[model samples]
Target: MSAAGPSLIEFVAKRPWLKKALTPLASWYGNAAGYRQLGLRADDLIPEDNERNLQALSRLPPKEAYDRIYRIRRATQLSLQQKILPRNEWTKPEEDTPYLSPIIERLAAEEKERDQLDTLGVLKKH
Candidate 1:
């Protein structure tokens, strides 16, 4: 999930044919991953132990933050009960979009830019 790693998504996305062919398989895999079954969005499963994820979580709107917490708590209760959410409560595909990823990417880009600036040396032409 780290931006530093090589991404199959990036590779596939570069080629239209590959992306088109894999779209359905990717959808199937997401469903197979089972997070949506518990009423949690895909972003909800992202590990929040990292600095970037923490920052992203902090940036979420108040309502979104509350919803995320509620979802996690509900999912935990369901897990203990050994039950999935009802069909109507499962996160739909359209609702499973990355809510935190954009923020994380923005933070990562800012961090990268800051690091670059920190190392920048001004060469004075005599």
Candidate 2:
């Protein structure tokens, strides 16, 4: 499982009406979370204390890694000053795309597969 825990994204997505109904709620929740005001993407809020996230961070492209670091540092600075980015400078909805999440999910899947393989047993021919 991902550090974020099991997600209902796939479940919601499979049903168009449910996804449509939840779209505004999700947007409102995202905005209310306030990370965008700090100029940070949702992915940046993910804790890096775990091995999977750390590995995923390491796999990010050079530009993406650099941008993530810059955003985090800037957010830290802004937080210390207790200020949010100007409205114009806040991260737009489109800009809040997931960069690290796919990698984390892939890593989790690989780990699960590895565990399954390691636990497999073969019977000897009689």
Candidate 3:
């Protein structure tokens, strides 16, 4: 956005554990944005923790940023299949997963299902 996009160090200072959780997303975003420099250094993002998530957002390429979004999309699907998240949330997948496509279609059996009503409504044991 700016000459200096986002400071990774500043970002991780508040949100620790982000690096570990979002490594896949960060790396992919960096790559997709066509960013030349990942700028990923353990010390850059985290001063005290010394383990910031990744690198310089500003130096990164646009392609890398895009890739990052895609990764997050994929991660979202995996979360659904694990049942950590629900399928209804995926009005459209962030990215498709091999496992979820067929099952998502089955939801089309009824309009209500396709409409993606609240889980309590769908699963309530009348």
Candidate 4:
């Protein structure tokens, strides 16, 4: 929800016709993004240094956290070597789900709620 820029996804998603027409385009764009070739999921491409993402990463289940770290390190090493993973090692589309996005969205919502509560005004009348 807290994207760095305006998202056309939400708009398109709300319209069934638009979503139907754009599904293939979106899939193609995801493939073209090239992270899958590096064996990384879309969530793995999110900047980990940011506060929200860091919190989300911390909240991940242990196995998920380990997998995320493994993928990131693998990607880093591959980038350094200027080599893509062998075809068999590439991330399959089904495996490229946004595992961390929901947690990040929850964290953002919690932060917003906390802000609201912290700023609440108290009124007393007798």
Local distance difference test scores for all models: 0.91, 0.94, 0.40, 0.89
Sort by lDDT, top down from the best: 2, 1, 4, 3
Alpha-carbon lDDT of model 4: 0.89
Instruction: Kindly indicate the candidate among 2 and 4 with the higher lDDT.
Output: 2
Q: Which candidate number maximizes lDDT?
A: 2
Q: Which candidate model has the greater lDDT, 3 or 4? A: 4
Instruction: Using TM-score as the measure, name the better of candidate 2 and candidate 4.
Output: 2
lDDT per residue as tens, model 1, 1-126: 456576687788789999999999999998999889999998898888888889999999999999999999999999999999989989999999888888999998899999999999999999
Clashing pairs in 4: none
Which residue ranges in model 1 land beyond 4 Å of their true spot?
A: 1-4
Q: Higher lDDT: candidate 1 or 3?
A: 1
* lDDT tens digits by residue: candidate 2, 1-126: 346678897899999999999999999999999999999999899889989999999999999999999999999999999999999999999999999999998998999999999999998999
How far residue 108's Cα lies from its native spot in candidate 4, in Å, is 0.6
Using TM-score as the measure, what is the rank order of every candidate, best first?
A: 1, 2, 4, 3
Worst 10-residue lDDT window, candidate 2: 1-10
- Model 3, range 1-126, lDDT digits (tens) per residue? 112244475576567688678768866764454212222222122222211122233233578546545545555566556533343443222322233222222432443554665454645586
Would you estimate the TM-scores of all the predictions?
0.93, 0.92, 0.22, 0.90
> Candidate 2, which segments miss by more than 4 Å at Cα?
none
